[model samples]
Target: MKAVHFGAGNIGRGFVGLLLHEAGCEVVFSDVAESLVQQLQQADSFTVTTVGQHPTTTVVEGFRALNSDQDPETLTEEIASADIVTTAVGARILRFVAPSIAAGIAARPAGAPPLAVMACENAINATDLLEQEIRANYQGEDLEEKALFANTAVDRIVPVQAEGAGLDVTVEDFFEWAVERGPFGGNEPDVPGITWVDDLAPYIERKLFTVNTGHATTAWHGWAAGHATIAEAIRDPAVAIEVETVLAETSSLLSARHGFSEDDMASYRAKVLGRFANTALPDPVERVGRGPLRKLSREDRIIGPAAALAERGLEHEGLLSAVAAALAFTPEGDEEVDRLQDLLRTTSADAATLEITGLAPDHPLHPEVRALIAARITGP
Candidate 1:
């Protein structure tokens, strides 16, 4: 079997690529970075170092690189004939890659075995969104029969590594990649380490509300506290308390919404917090809090669950507090952060809130967020 994966970055190589290679597939990584492409092309393989109690290194091979910009024909051809396709590119970049995917699906040889397309992103129904993008450009016959798009919920911590690490990726040992099996036209792809499920909502929400929400909570709060790394920020008593509170709020919401047992949710929250505190990972607060615009959006980790909580008349103060911290996040050198600050500066509180988060002025949680941002501007 062969697989063509987009993005040869940390998560791509360490998590998705590693698993795909272990599943006995020849992995072809497609990226726009000339340096990274050349690195992957020259190096026979790279290393994956898992950071945890029993840290171990594994050699990941059976993979090469293709520069998507320079080699569109080869990329499309690879995708056309490959057994499967996957992407770890951030969700926002999905649209940019959609044209290539559409081209590849169009170029797929007739009567060839069906292709499985799974988007391993942090966002909910990422594959569905990617498929929507692909469908926009597709005008080919029997596209549905020719391809399967499976939505996936992937949870792993692939932090930024030290400079000059080359293709070597250091990541957390704990990971989860769940895919909805309902989309498959026939037998599901037998990729090991993936949990195939009929309904993916529960799993997706569980990971999003627990892992992502908790991580963002830590990052925003940690940034507000002027801590450089997640380990340092999480070590502070106040920061840790705020993170736990946000997790508690989201946990209650998740348990109630998804029919998850409160006890199990509690365990999950604790485990996620433990991961955040792992010193070996040492993720920078600025890196985790980089994309403030997306992070502050309504459907994202912070506001999504918070809005649901408000609709339920449940406790969401912790999440709202995190929102305030996010507003205060002005990490230097991030263009998005600069733009967000400029928007917040020029617009009214309610207007800025609506524009940034897609929430109406009358949204139940809108006033709370506005008031929090207001408090940050004026002395409480």
Candidate 2:
């Protein structure tokens, strides 16, 4: 078997890349970074280390890079030939990978075998979104055998490890990728390198509510406090309380919507909090909160649950307040800040809040966001 994976970053090498290699698939790492690409091509292998729940290092071999830009011809052939394709590229770069996808489709040989493109992103609708962008340029039989875009929910704490020469990646050994196999079809959870599940809603809701939401709450709350590390930040009562409260907000909506029993949900939430409280993990709050803009998007962590609550006629004051705090993150060189500033400056408070936060102007949570902004903004 052969696999072509996008993104050679930490998650790429540590999770997806290593898993594929172990599953007995020849791996072709696809990335845009020239240095990393060259390194993969030159070395033919890399190393992955799990930093959580029993740290261990292992060498991953029989892999090389397919420089999509420089080696377009090869990428096209590989895409057609490969049995499976996966992506770890942050959702924002999904478009940039479209051309390579089109080329690969064009390069598929006659009677080419079916392929799957599993986009392992933090969002719920990632695979569908990628298929849309990838199909914009595709047509005919190529479109018919068009790869499957499997919606996947991945969970792990892969903190940006210490930078150095080796390819060792420190990540939590506890990881999960629940792909939306749908009612008709689902992922092969039993598959050596994949976990297929029917009805992605439950799995996604569980992971996001537990990992992403809980983790971000720690970040925003942590950033508010003097702590830099996630473990340190959660040590503060205020931060811990805020995280627990937000999780409670999400847990209520989740249980009501998904039929997760209150008892089971409580246990799950406790497990998530325990993951955070593991000082041994030493996950940094800044790293979790680094890409504030992406993390704050309507489809991403903070806004996703908020939108869910709105649809079900539930109150999301805590969620909206968290988003309001996210918008206040004025980090230098962040495009989201620039975009948000424009929206805030050009629109009324109601419209600005809705526009950036993805809630309707009349959303029940909108007033809370307005109040949050008011209390924080020092108006003359």
Candidate 3:
């Protein structure tokens, strides 16, 4: 078996590529980073170190790399005959990669087994977004016959690599790659790392609301409290209290909407918090809190659950606090953070609230968000 995986970064190499290699598939990494692509092309192998309770290292080999920017034809050819195509690229990047995938699908010969494509991104239904982009780019008939797209929920914490750690990744031991089974018709890729589920919505929500939400909340609150790393922030009693409060609010929404048992959510919440507090990971607050605007979106980690909770007349103050902190995140290099700061400075409170969170004026959570933005704009 062969797989074409996009985004040869830490999550792609450490989690997704490692699992694909273990599944006995020859992995082809398609990346636009010239240096990274050249490194993979020249190197024989790389290591993935899983840190935490059971620390172990595995060497990944028998993989090929292509510079998707300079060698599109090669990548398209690789995708044409590939059995599986997966991406760890951010949700926003799927559009850029879609045309190549569409070209690959068009190049496939008749009667070929449908290529299984999954986007292992943090966002909800990321593969669906990829599929939409591919559909827009594809000119061939019977698009469904050429590719099978499955939405996935992936959870793995990959911290910034130490300097000079060439192609090597250090990630937390805990990882989950849950894929929807209904899309594959029982012929899912032979990836042992996957937990195939009949319904992926609950898993997606559970991970997004708990892991993503808690992680971002910790980062934002941690930044506000003058903390550096996630471990440091989560260990701080004040930050921890705020994060737990946000998780509690999201937990209630999950239980109320998804029918996830209270006990189950509590266990999940505890495990997630413990992961954040893992000193071994040392995820930086700036890195996690970089995309403040996206995190504050109406359907994203903070606002999504908060909006739902508000609609149900549930308490969402904790989430709103996180939102306020998110607005205060002003990291140096993040484009989103720069844009967010600009919006806050130049735009009106109501306009900025609607623009940032995509919340309508009549939304149940609108007034609170607007008020927060107004406070942020006016200052103390």
Model 1, range 1-380, lDDT digits (tens) per residue? 89999999988999999999889899999999999999999999899999999998999987889999999999999988898899999888999998998898888888987889999987888898999999998887678878899999998899888898999999999999899988874488879878898899989988987788777778888888889898888889999988888888888888887788888988888788888889999799988887888888878888899999998999988888888888888878988788788876676666677778888877888888877755544221
Q: For candidate 1, give the lDDT.
A: 0.87
What CA root-mean-square deviation does each model show from the true structure? Answer: 2.0, 2.6, 1.4
lDDT of 3 by residue, 1-380 (tens): 99999999989999999999999999999999999999999999999999888899999999999999999999889999999999998887999999999999999988999999999998889999999999999987878899999999999999888899999999999999999999889898889999999999999999999999999999999998999999999999999999999999999999998899999999999999999999988789998887888788878899899999989999999999999899888878899998888888888898888899999999899999999999877422
Model 1 vs. true fold: TM: 0.96
User: Could you tell me how far off, in angstroms, the CA of residue 279 lies in candidate 3 after the best superposition?
Assistant: 0.7
Residue pairs in candidate 2 whose N, alpha carbon or C atoms collide under 3 angstroms: 51-171, 181-185, 181-186, 187-196, 189-195, 189-196
- Worst 10-residue lDDT window for candidate 2 reads 182-191
Instruction: Indicate the residue-level lDDT of 168 in model 1.
Output: 96
Best by TM-score: 3
What lDDT does each candidate get? 0.87, 0.75, 0.92
Candidate 2 ranges with C-alpha deviation above 4 Å: 182-190, 310-315, 341-348, 373-380
Residue 111 error, candidate 2, Å: 1.2
lDDT, residue 54, model 3: 85
Question: Using Cα atoms with residue i matched to residue i, what is each candidate's TM-score against the true structure?
Answer: 0.96, 0.90, 0.98
